[model samples]
Target: MAISKLRCLGLVVMVTAQMVSAETLSPAQAPVAALDAAEPTVAAIAPQVDAEQWVRQTTSNLSSVRYINQLAALYLANGYAPLWQDSLATTALEEQLQLLALSGVSADFSRRYAQLAHLKQSNDWRQYDLLATDTLLAYMSYLEGLPEYGRGWLFGAGIDPSLPLPSSQGLNHLNSAIETGQLHAFIAALKPQDRRYTQLQRAIDALAQHSQASWPGFYQPGYIRLGTRLQQPEALITRLEQLGDLTPYQAAQLRTSNVRIYNIDLANAMKRFQERHGLKVDGVIGPQTRYWLMMPVQERIRILALNAQRLRLWPADFPSMLVVNIPAYDMSLWLDNKHVLDSKVIVGRPSRPTPLMSSTVASVVFNPYWNVPNSIMRKDILPKARYDRGYLYRNGFRVIRSWDSSEQIPIHTIDWRLVNAKAFPYRLRQQPGEKNALGRFKFNIPNNNAIYLHDTPAKSLFNKTTRAFSSGCIRVEHADDLARILLTDSGVSPQRVDELKARTNTRTVGLSNQVKVHLIYQTAWVDEDGQVNFRNDVYSYDQINPMSQKEEKFTFLFSGENPY
Candidate 1:
């Protein structure tokens, strides 16, 4: 319960004079004697202001005190006592802040921590304390994306991500921990112990070893087929060898060849590279492949670091849950630490990108109806209905007055072209049949986005590596197999579930123990072999945090260039 204050944040925060006082530290608590310089301490500031009232009001209204970061408010409220007074906590805080850059926290964060070493020399313990806490809070905000499984890093949407945790009771628990003097312990436990974090950490360590290694310059070949002699085959060989696409033995043989050629083995390796990088895996070096080939090793480390920062929010206690990695286009079902199922999934296309969120599938609906959303109906369906006379009927679609009403309206009565899209009163419902959009299974996860995982009649989309076809909902490929597993988990026998499925009629079964669903958008991960797998940032989030090119960005810790 050390970090319990944030383990869960409650909506209701109870503050008393004692709690407020505890949050506010006085100058007596500062280790001024430990400081080499005669810096101004908290005792010098407390006599000037009504500490209790100021703190109470500041903590009470986060909006009005937006200018005063939580750290500053706490320091002022505490009579300017430094929170990082303990050398152990101080050292740990500073190191963590500096290391945040390597974790791909953000360029803005890098700039802040870069100054922490130099800030306290002239500043009051209060200013140093404020900057320290601000940096710490920013790093912890990565946990805000704990729900997205990858949302915590890369500068939060300019809002305090730490507030509004799971519940107020959890928040109170964290507060209690703080009141009990477990704040240092709380800061200690801030970094997560996720397995992915471990892998990415290893990856970065490996990349850091190669960070100074020279990579070949950018390549832009028109196109290269197998056996084609290339102008920069030597450079390409160096790039492939450096990228691990070609082994030493392979490169040695290729290097010995008098004529540098795009051979079969190299092309195959390029295909593997293309597949891993979310490019067209045609085994031909083209513009996209050449672009990735030219990417710097430091950039690779930066990408891995950013992903590591985000994935650090992945809980150590990963319970039985379903995870859909949106960018990777895959869904995984985990049960008791084992991967139960992994199925290809077609996610929302770019035009209607899948919303990242977390929810619970409390029940499974079989042979479900596809209630056309107004947005889809107006944007997608209306255009077709006016052009194709039998488009609606052929697709098992029927017009209905409202969502709740089962009574079907005469589809022929409504004029497709004359209807005003903004005021379209009719609802389009797809009947439960072979042609139904919701093929035969729908995992219901209620959310404001009005999206759910369901089966689709279009199976061909799953064949494509990039399966971003549906408007906004998820279309699971092996939905029937998933349904069987879920139904059995819900206490229904497999045989019984099969019997229900054979009936070919609409039905729903309650999932006795609701399963957790996390829709994540990770672009990099480590496989079982500890190989770093990278993917295209379909949504371009990976480009958000571009680490500065300065070498000092990675080297300020023990250099003592600026020590607190």
Candidate 2:
């Protein structure tokens, strides 16, 4: 079985190599081929270095060739090779892989890898390569089908019969497909005057009038919907058939319509997209979905390539836990692979963007005191406190009258308002209760941000799609459910939470056992069926592609290491 798999992978590699060599504009084959006429030949450079000496120097500092090879193998297995094909993407992979290689995969590597390893272990490179190959193949298949969904467009020139695809006019393809007789082809299928065709014509015309309109890339305000990427009607119909649940009319609307999506409708489409991507569906397009969508196709191809390069990164045996997608701005509490609760959350704003880290929820704080951050205190609260003595009290803050670092002593009682900005010596701490900023419960995950996932008094923010409202903390909507889960896990009976909520005195609730909480950023996610879904990078991070600027520094090193 293993041999067969290896042979199949070898065949795939050979076919891929041939296709890559034949189909793509090679690194060596520039569009301006004549420009390389003066460049040095391979023979001219051959005698400049000693291979044995170079290998020895490169190997001396590294303790493990096997380790380097494993990392390289793992990256290769994950299918990062597709990234190499796109001239625009190769440098990003090279730079990131170099940084990671330099830093070494942190404890995160172990946390994520342990779970994958448990599923299976490879005893040899051949086995690793086979598994990686399978992983890559699966990812490729998923990606190839990605364009069929509205997440992206796959561009090819002309109607190439050799390839099993129709040509795309690109996502920003201008000019009308106003082939004279083609109007009937699109309109005949609609209800005699289904306004869809007329609206579609109007949209097409608008698109044409604005043909010179900027292709603000993917994240722009007036971007295309996730559906219309399909240039052919039949392909759209076929994809909808596979999607299931979608009505024929709705699918038709998607195929024929030329509508620009807003945050709300985009949020809805994003949820349906999320459901297809294996995430907890809440109708809000969060970070993970955005990461998945906006991820460079090359990056995805690399991820797939690397999966087959080594032993499994995830161990089959693992603890029951919660996986919070930092990018998706969502959380999923799981026990034995079953979901306990899921909800939407407001992560840090772009300026104070949330960090991507993982930690165990060692404790749950009930009616926890909000110790304001220095930045917030100095910038927002202190100014208000100085301007209005009642501001602190109005916002439910209690000023610690006075305290020395070594001794606690009552100082002169200066009216909070009357005191000059420099005279304030007290720290501000809010009492945890109903009126508290942190609502009732906050899941504690230790980190530098002093940030935790918690409930909020301001529930109205959840209704908005763009909730960059928080200073730098995550606020949850279904916080109560999360609290109950933590309490139950911590050995506090469900009945006890009801008991605690009624109490007027402030107190804290600690979980019985530690639950791992991951504050990760994943803009891209795959559905249960392995369909990749995307989200809007509300912060516009996608616009920073290296290719966008010529002055950017870049390098491409051909190290035989894993690239993930």
Predictions in order: lDDT:
0.66, 0.43
TM-score of 1: 0.73
Clashes within 3 Å, all models in order: 10, 58
Candidate 2: residue 12 Cα off by (Å): 30
The pairs that clash in candidate 1 are 4-174, 5-174, 8-170, 8-171, 9-167, 10-167, 10-168, 24-78, 25-78, 142-152
Would you give me the overall lDDT of model 1?
0.66
- RMSD values for the candidates in order, in angstroms, are 11.9, 19.7
Superposition error at 20 for model 2 (Å): 38
lDDT of 1 by residue, 1-564 (tens): 111211111111112322324334433232223222223221223523354454443244222222244544455544444455555666767655655565444545666666666555544344455456556555555454344334423422322223332344433543554556666777667656567776877777776776787776746458889878778777887787777778888888888874477788789889878877877889988877877888888888777777766665444366788999888999999777778999999887766667666788888888887788777787778788888869998998999988788788898888877877668888888889899888999888867667789998888888887788777788999999889888787799988888888877789888987788888777888877766688767666665543332331232112111000
Q: 1-564 in candidate 2: lDDT tens per residue?
A: 122322222212222222333233221221221212233221101112233342233334332122333223323333312111222222322222322222122222222233223322433223233232222222222323333320111110111111122123211110121122232232222122322223322322332443353322333223234443323334323333333323567656655664333324334655665565555566543466544444443343323222211112112233667765544567778765667888878876766655444567767666777765545566667777666667766677766644334332232255545654444566566777667778887778766546677889888877665565666567888988888877787789778888886776666766657777765444443434534444445444333222211122111111111100
TM-score of each: 0.73, 0.48
Off by over 4 Å in 2: 1-317, 401-424, 538-564
Per-residue error at 314 for model 2, in Å?
A: 8.8
